[model samples]
Structures are given as structure tokens and as C-alpha cells.
Target chain A: MDPDDLQAEPLSSGVPDLPPSDIGMSVEPATEAGAESDSSDTSSSSSMLEDDLLVLRRAWINERNSPELYTYEGAALENLMELVDFQLQSLDAQPASIQNDRVKYLVRSYLRTRLNKVEQHPGYVLREMKERLSQAELEYAEGFRSLQDAHVRKSFLDQFPAHLRRVDEETKDGLKMVPEPDMDRAVFCRVRTTVGQFQFDERYVSRQRRPAYLVQTTNMQCVVRTRSS
Target chain B: MLGDECFKLAKEAKDVTPDHIPAYNEELVRLVTQESRYLWRRVVELIQATESSSQQSSSGVFSPSQSTSKPDLSSQPFSNDPADVSRSMESENMQGQVALYVHTIERNKRCLMAYHRKRAEFLQSLLWAVHLAPTMVPQNVSQRLAPEEQNYAREYAKLNMKYRDSVEATLCPNDSLDWALNGEVPPRDLLIEVRVHRDCGEIVTQSGIVNLQAGTQHYLCRSDVEHLLTIGYLEHINPT
Candidate 1:
């Protein structure tokens, strides 16, 4: 069978063995009741849906711009893209009530599509961070190997410890070693932070005045004076 | 509220199904309803706040008596007075928006429930397939399953003969797997990639010992990792 033909068929049809009540009747009453009660609550809910739509729209735009979204299985991605397009088109053609419903579905599908991209896979930021860390490690290893060969190193620390450290470690060590290349000296220099004098005031100062205390004299002072006299 | 009732019913139905498949249908419905309700309340608050502010600003130009009556004006749902046509129009627009939102929520609830039901049915069918042909449980099939799903499939396969016979009689005869084992040739062993989600030491397979660690990916025969996949410790990855 053609792959396209399989896509056209409802994917849910794969499981048709469920009891009629299990699949159908059990759901209808609850939804109808929900719809009825929802009417009473609609005034309040309408504004909520608008906010949800706004967030969903923003998310959809972000997904479209995301580079990782393209990595999704071709058929699923195409289907979601088409669904979004259809929803947008219908928004104009339908009445406000219908349009509102369509917008919710659109937002939901958009979220699901975005979710499908990352559901099994790790988040884009995490994967990117891992890749960057690995690349940095590889670069550091390459730099260390090259430095070892140039300095006739034995232990890991001996290769570039003292004079080599003065030059920016990020640059080629060869340029720093040979003084003839004065033009490249600027590139080899490390950028250092300069400290300036800073003044700081005490955070807390006591505002309350000290209490006065009366001094009491004992008979010992008079007795001593009399004895001396 | 209605979503909650549906969720309760779905949960009840879950008890009738096999133990292995996690009953996520109820939880999904509950989450959707809860989220929708919170959003609805926020929207109402926003609309009310904006309306009250606009009334306050507009009332500043009017007399004290009219200003005093502003609370009443806000309380009234609709105004028949011709002078307040614009206010009435705005109210109608808001109502329409609300109606649209309610309809959308109801539709979403129904769709989610249907998907849940379908998923449960699919699991039942998969169990039936396992019961019919234990050996035909392909390596790729096991690898595709999560750990819990594998356990569930295996556990269901181990049900007593009476239960299996009853399931066989009731199960729909139109499943694609009904004819899976009719062919003459023996099933060939397929090489597949399995990614360990959790650490598992030296699994002895027909081929050799396969050591697994979290975040490690390995290529092995389908049979070696089928149990691991079903139990959710390992996930199947398409070979790059």
C-alpha cells in the first residue's frame, strides 16, 4: 500500500476491537453536560481562551523558527504544517464562534507538534550544551597535545607552566616563543582586569541615645580620707 | 466539572483492562479541564477589571448621580437603552468569544477521551497478538515498547488458558496481526539499536552478554533487549 494512503486513513483505526459502550456512549453524556455547563461559564472562559490563543500563537511562531523542528519525521511534520495552514485559512472563512473553536484546536495541534519534536529527544538547549562542551574538550585536548610536542614535555604540567602561561593560552604558543613576530604580539597578550579604589560605608548605624546612669559613692572613700588625715 | 466525571468513568474502566498499560486517560482529562478552568477564570477577571476601569474613567465626566449609579450599570447583564448601543455591542462580542471558548474546550475534552479509549484498545489488541503467537513477538516490537508496556504484554501473555480463550473469542477478527504467523518461513533475527534509560548489568542473550548503562547506546539483536524495552529501562533508537 502507498504510504500516503495509509496516512489518509485515521491512525486510531488500528484498534477497532473495543466495545461500543467503552468507546462511544460513555463519552457523549459527559461532554454534552460539559458543553451545557460550559455555556454558563463561557463569559469567564472566553477571555481565558484568548490568552491561551495568544500563548499558543507565540509558541507556534517560535516552533516555526526553531532549527530542530525540521528534524522531525517528514510525514508527521508535513501533516502538522498542513493542519496549521488549514486552521489559519478557516479562521477567516468561519464565524467568530467557529473561528474561536478552530483557534483552540490550532493552538493544541501546534503544541502537540512541538512536543512531538522533543518528547522522546532531549531539549534543544540541553543537546546544544552537550555538543558545545564536547567540542571544547576536543579543542583543549588538541591544544595540550600540540603544546606537549613543542615543549618536549614529560608530565602533564611541565609543557606550558611558567613562561608559556604569561601569553594568552587561547593563542598559538609558537608566536609567543618567537619574538620576531611583533605584529602578532597584541593577539597573544591576555586581557586583565584592573582594580580601582572603592569606598564602602557601614550598613548599620545605631540611632538610639545611651541612657544616663547615677553614680553612688560608698562610705569607704570618706573612711580612707579620714585615715589619711 | 464534567471532565472530572468523565475522568472518573475512565478510571473505573481502567480497572477492567490489563494491569500493565498505565491509565493516563483520566489524568490527561483532569489536566486539560483544570488548565481550561484556570485560564477561564483569569480571562473573566481580566475582562471585569478592564470593564470596571473603563467605566471609572468614563464616569469621571458625568454627574455625581450617574457616577453613583455606575455600580448598577456594571451589574446589569444587558441594556435595552438606545444610547448604550456601543456598550451592548461590546458585551455581545465578549459573549461570542466566550461561546467560542466553551465550544473549543468541550471539543478538546471529547477528542482526548477518544484518543485514550483508542490507546487502551490498541493495548488489548497487542496482548491478543502476543497470546496467539508467543514466538512471533518480533524483536522490533519489543524494542518499540516502554519497560512497563513490555511487562504488561508479558504478564498478559501469562494469563490462564481460560482467560486467553475468552479474549480470543471476543477480540475483533480484523486485526492486522491475525495473519502474522501464517507464513511458512521462520522469523529472521533483526539487528536493532537500544538506548539504556537505566543501568542494567550483563544481560545474557542467545548471542552474548550485553552490558547496559544509563545514557549508553548499543546495537544488539531484537530478542536481547525486547524485555528491557517493554519494561521501559531501554528505548529503541533508529540507527543513524
Candidate 2:
């Protein structure tokens, strides 16, 4: 995947489908069954399809690596959906309906990951980072939050006095009730481009060289993966 | 014991191997919930005292030490000197204890949430894996869920379908698209041979009805047998 794709690009159109060919897959022997497999198993898809697939892959990798949600790629997903639906209806392409499944699987994974993150850090997502979610995801977030609030209230919070019923406030420990993602945690990275130098913790001076970078993941949104390397 | 019960529940929630769902720990959950309520009540009592006292003074709500207002009503009934410096010190000490109790209560809440959320996640995944067919959930799995958890699973399954339909609404609507179907690796061949492992009775496939008595073999579309493959009713026959 191109490192440049990590930088913010103009909103292309639709959901950048995930390549969830891995995690949560019920079937076995699942390894990189993505674009390369798409090409090998069938005659080459049109260049446009290939391009859309690349965008989807880039989106998938970006969402997979980053702790924070990126903007949704709605246009690319819509286009791919039309194409996959077309292929499914085609007489010859019906056998390759597996292609549609792959696309659907990837898209489902992308959405699922976002949902996981939303559920994990609802306070942060609902307050500071809502712009990153698509319309459907936004609705899901609001609904899930209310669902949670209702659950918490019905289950135990109601047992407490009205003042203590509040769940999202800071605790007496001076820590937040809702945990935000720990950005300061160290994350391993591979350098796509060399940087001359950057200060670490205002104490140590370090230089990033090509092929590897082991920096704390805080605010380091550009998670470039050197898959070919 | 303040955190031990919740910590144990959290550890069990994370086990992903050898089938994810474990039988609900009803007794422990009840105990934890009771402890949480007890601690939370204490915290509220302390905080309420703090709030009432702080409202009379100009000092910040949390900064009981920096308080300049006279500590009149804060003195204990048994105290000889109601205005003594020790009176303010006592309130400060109470504030510190409140902080500790609040921490314990919140931590307890987090653990409880983690356990419940983990089970909820498992339920959602199982429902999706079976393509939203609740009846397809294995009997052992169904029996393990708590009654309340069972209700949550049913409601959540319905919500999940609506969520998927809304996701579909983002795309063209004419052709029915199933996002949860065949969440497996794309097979190189569209059709594969499979041997029945158990008596599945007569089952209809994409082709036609086939009796799935033990040892019966048939070639079927991978998608057609996908559910059976997951449920262990049939075994994939790899052609050598």
C-alpha cells in the first residue's frame, strides 16, 4: 500500500471496505485473501474495479492500524456494491459469487471494527470525534449509548441516590469514568519515509530511519505498513 | 476483597480459545453488584455531605483544604470545640476517604461492564455467524446465557438486522445484499465435496434435497454448505 494514502485525501465517495479476511472469520485457512486472490482466481477485473479495490485495501489497512476512526469512504463502497451486484446477476459471473461475499465480508469487518471502537470509547467518540463516523454509524452510536444508559440505570445505577446515578462523570479518584484510548502506549511502526530528527518526551533526541520505527503511538495517525518489505 | 471479585470476572471474560462463551457466573455477578451498590451508597453519602458543606462556602467543591468559610455545621455532634482547627481537618479526612470509595465503586462498575459487554459481543458474533438465525445457536451456547443476557441477545439480534439494513440503504436497494453471509475465506473452487458426519436428516441444498445420513457424501456449493460446515454436521472432502 502507498504511504501517501495515509495522508488525508479528498473524500472519494463511500465506505472504504475493510480487508477483514482475517479476524472473526469462522472459516479456516484465512490469510491475505484480498486483491491478489481476487486477481488470481478470476480473469483480471476492470482497471476501475482494481482501483476501487486498492482504495478499499488502503481504507482497511488505515482503519486496522489506527486507534482513531478515519473518515468513511462512502463513494468507493457504493461503486463496488453496484459492480458486485452486476457480476452476481451476470450468467458467467454467478459462479464467482464468492467475489460478492468477499466484498461484503470486508465491508462488514470495516463497519464492525468501527462499532467495536465506538462501544469501547463512547464518551470520546460521541464528544470529540463524531465527525469521523458515517450517518448509519452515527445513528448506531447514539442508539448504543442510550441502550447502555438504559441498561446501566435498570441494572444497578438506580439503586444509588440521584446524585450518584451519573456514570460518565469523573470519579473521586480524579480519573475519568469513561476510558479514552491510551495514546501514550508504545506502538511498533515501519518507516515509509525517513525523518531527520524528532524530540522524544523533550528529553531524548532520536532519528527515524527507513524500514523501522518504534515510537509511542500517541497522535501518530500515519500508520504506514511496508507489506512488500 | 474490594477488587478481587471483579478482577476475577474480568479475567474469565477474555478467554477466547476452546469456544468463547462460558456459563454465566450468576453468583459472582450478584455478589459484585451488591458490593458495587454498597460502595456507591457510601460514596454518595460522603459526597452529599461534601456538597451541602461546600455550598455554604466560596471554596471549590473538591478543594476542602483551601476552604476559608467557617466550619460550623461540619463539626461532629460529640465534638467539644465545634470551631476548632481539628474540625476542618476532619472534613478533609472525610473527603480523602470519599475519593477512595468513589475509586473502588467506579472500578467495580468497569469490571461489571466488561463482563457484560464481553458476553454481549459473543452473542452478537454468534448471531451474525449463523446469519441472524437465533434457532441456529447451539443448545449448549443458549443454555449458558443468563435470563437477562438471553433477553439482551434477542433484542440485540433484531437491532443488528436493522443496522445491516441501514448499511444496505447506503448502497443501491433493488438487489438484496447480505453482509453477514459466508464470512469465510474465498474458496478457489465454487463447489466442494463434503461428507456428512451426523444425521442431518433430509436437507435441501442449492441443487436439491439430499439425505445427510452419516457417511453420505455429496458435492455442493460452498455457500450452500457453509452453515453445516460451521455447525460440524459435514466435513469438507479435500480432493487429493
Candidate 1: where are CA atoms >4 Å away? Answer: A1-229, B1-83, B132-139, B142-240
Which stretches of model 2 miss by more than 4 angstroms? A1-45, A92-94, A172-174, A182-215, A222-229, B1-100, B172-178, B181-186, B199-211
Give model 1's docking category.
incorrect
Q: How far is A42's C-alpha from truth in model 2 (Å)?
A: 16
DockQ of 2: 0.24
Best by TM-score: 2
The residue pairs in collision within model 1 are B146-B230, B146-B232, B147-B230, B147-B231, B147-B232, B150-B230
lDDT of 1 by residue, A1-229 (tens): 2222111000122122333233222223323333554456644343433344443443343343332332212233233233333333444433222232233234334433443333222223233322422232223323332332322222111322133222222222232211121111111111111112211133222212222111111211221122112
Report the Cα lDDT for residue A220, model 2: 51
- Per-residue lDDT of candidate 2, residues A18-71 (tens digit): 234432231221122224344343423444566666677667655655566667
When summed lDDT is taken over every stretch of 10 residues in candidate 1 chain B, the lowest stretch is B175-184
